[model samples]
Target: MNEMHHRMARTCMVYTSAALLALLPVTACGDATEDVPTKTVDTSALQPGSYPTEPRNVADRKPANAASIREAIRLAESMPLAMEVDKQYVYNQSSSGKIYAPELPPQQGDSVWVENFGAVIPGLVVGWTSNAQQREDFALGRNIDQTVLRFSNPDQAKHAAKVLSEDNRKDSPAKRDVRIPGHDAAISYVTEQDSVVTWMPHDDLLIYTFVTPGLEVPPDVDYVIGMTKTALDKNIEMLAGYQRTPTDEMPDLAIDTDGLLGRTLPVDDMNKSGATEGVYSPHAALHLRGRADVLKRAFDDAGVDLVADAGARVYRSSDSAAAYRLVAALIDQLDPRYETTDAPAGMPEAKCFKKSDRRSSRFTSIPQFQCLFTNGRYVAVVDAAQIQDLHQKASAQYLLLTDER
Candidate 1:
């Protein structure tokens, strides 16, 4: 028999043995049974085709304000992608629908509005923020944070825009009123360090944009103001396409209409505080990724429209071919600290990587091992501390995807 056949035979033997089963770690292994009697398997009858290639159906659950959350997610898709503001704004830090308090610019005073603004901004239904920077090093590149706040009516939104802008101005004597060209209704100001803050009301939404220059760059009021305008214009144009859920119907907005979240691995409660567990549109997902600019191109090329995040991340592409392209793109974009490694046993299509050194960075966490695998139109990524654990997770994820019931 060939070397490939020999390897498969060995893997089958190990999988079928009760001894190895007992040695396996207590990790997620889909449908893995315990305390099974050892059995002799006919290796000659086994083929690579035995592996699963399709995703199994999973049940969906709804949470409170599920419909409103779903609408916010759709609104996020309409938010200007960082690249649209500027190609250099490539590193997206955060994007979500859970905006409560305004994230003001640096050096801005701690206003009472920062703490009790929610009480004043009535009819606040939902909000989204798309924050990005030119580089991972915050001290070395420009940054832009665009926020969209939705209210029950246009009047309430208009009031919010005015109150938020005035509160910031009143809290800081260093804040000087500024005018944005061609935007008479825009409330803008230049604060210390030359950062620009602008608030504009559009229909039933309040659009807020903040821009800051790199520390090394000299403070240029015009440049910051220009960037603020650009961000506002992009946001306005993108939001024009958004169709908000009617105020009365927001409470009944359905969640997971596409069922992407149901198939994703659920997040651990222990890690819930730090994890963003939900289904997101492609642009919204970019805000949660590293090297988002590069991923945007890959996503566009692969026709990736939906992404689900929890314990593991799942990306839905247009087809098997597109999924493969996305996998390749992801592998190619790995940080320099990682190196390619062997895939899970008997799973040739899966790609795995291991960190090569203990390089520390305040901005990012480096996982010890990461594995990416695909099932039909879906691609999933899982991280683990050990190669063995990674393999087990990959195996379980594969089975989970293939499980039809």
Candidate 2:
């Protein structure tokens, strides 16, 4: 794999998908439809299973807004996220939908979560990387790292840096001051491999990075110090004043796409109509009826709002296979409460249920296969749109979750 993929392909990519027609009026949903030259970013440029990491923008570049965010997403969408998972490597196709990682990431899923800042997201450590070598080190559970963390504001971010620095200086017998970036900064070296963890306070964000090899790899403090200087130079502008949002259209998530039941590429795959739209993260209208609180708690735990009426239309495919594909992609990304263990007979053992709200319309309940399940985090779920079996249009995608390997 190329270095870029090594850096950017570290799990925690949140998969979200919907049917082509599930999302309507492309202008809505914050998608930019400007007529730009058509371009196909073949992933080969970055090596198999990876792409270039987004350059640091908030610091030197203009802060990103809704329009810019959409433009980037559109650009990323235009590219094909094809990885050569050919027969060479033996991938455990099962277990591809684990919501949280089994261990501290570089694992998958739970590696990247929204920063809680004060009380919201705890134990949430954000790391940024741009080097392929370093990327491999991180994924393999090594100490070499170069990841970025964003915050709502600069004050909170700087305070966080200070706290981190203070906490990490106790690793050595002779308590010495940790090396920080600037005179007004504090630093820490928690491990010998990670010589110094410098926190650079930039506009609207804080960058915590290290360039030193593991303490065991080399004790070249000079080299380590040089990297610290480089980090300070590149991230100087990233400190404070500029306030904006962070967006990386490239899906950094991982899932076993081959695990998808029908691995054979269908010539007339689900894209028969050139369907390019997939509804991901749409507000689901769940009827509470007498179970308002019960459903509300479910929705709350599910991290979505439960409404008696939904503003958007949720269309179900007439094709059972197409519909099955849609629901499968949804399960792969949404991580909904599909733990009812209610899969259909003869189908693979999956946690599926026919539980639907009373207000369910014909659109959601199309005449087709309605079961849903996915492999736990076995493979990376980069592109949901590509997974829907297009050739199997006439039939429904009645795939089953695989048994434990």
Candidate 3:
């Protein structure tokens, strides 16, 4: 995908519920009764040279604080998902600390200190925002945001938490101190806008949580406190298993350590340098998806350990059977407007879908066509505006995945 299109896909929030799949019909093979036109490609004559087998290597490719940036991405996967706090908070967005300036605070006055604090900016900051309703109408439901700031040591984390709490309390007199149930060191207060904010320092990391109610109800202090507690507890538990990279070894951190990105197809040569195209852990991949809650279970069941996003999204499953199951699960979770039409001509293992006449103003930006296919333990998903283009991309992706070299 191009840079512009990748940005749009990252922020766009239209999603279909997993439960809705029961109402739609899907087929692994083409529907004979459907008159959808398909393009046929000569698979036997396809050459591996037609698609990129390895990611391009740029000279002097290192970015500023590359090690810290990479560690921040790793920390993001350990952060708690919104659904873990409450089932209602199934919608979420993930962000890395690298997005902000390391030496300066965020421009917004009421922003979380984890993004960037006065002289005490953390080595890395990762966050997730979960909502009870769809993005188009999030104001109608509850929302919770969780952020983790990893400092150089326990002392720095404690100092950063202290500085943030003191500064925030002095910023406005309307802020009222609120006591958490079991966290005595936690500094929490209710803002004038009725949102609850909490900052707690644990070991070498600072945990931040913000809870806000929907427009339909008055701010519930008890609900806010309960949710904040749940978020903190879950984060602490998950972090116990995470091993932070040593400060001295961060700069040498490898980008494609497992060679997954090298094997995946790359975008067109002109747009190959985009930052959005990279390999990610299964948990990190959830941040880029719309229905992360539903996909989480599928990812775990299929043992989907790695994901690579380039011209096509590639997933590494445990085995071929798991890959096929993942593809079926993906097709079932597609928006209801998409109907199973046909597989790419001459490729029975592939499955394709096209948007039907059904109209919904909420999902206009979604791609009109998508195709999914598996080659051994790897599953690839490709999208396009035209059926012919989708078929060609699918064929090329299949060849790239099956290449022996």
- Give each model's clash number: 1, 47, 0
Model 3 ranges with Cα > 4 A deviation: 1-51, 54-66, 94-137, 154-175, 214-216, 267-278, 336-349, 352-369, 384-396
Models, CA RMSD each: 13.8, 20.3, 7.4
Clashing pairs in 3: none
lDDT of 3 by residue, 8-30 (tens): 33334332111112111232235
The number of residue pairs in model 1 that clash at the backbone is 1
Tens digits of lDDT, candidate 1, 269-338? 4122222356788777765545666677677766788887655778887876667666766766566677
Write model 2 residue lDDT over 59-98, tens digit each, in one string: 2222112223222222222211101111111111111111
Instruction: Find the 10 residues in a row with the least total lDDT in model 1.
Output: 15-24
Worst 10 residues of 3 by lDDT: 16-25
* TM-score of model number 2: 0.32
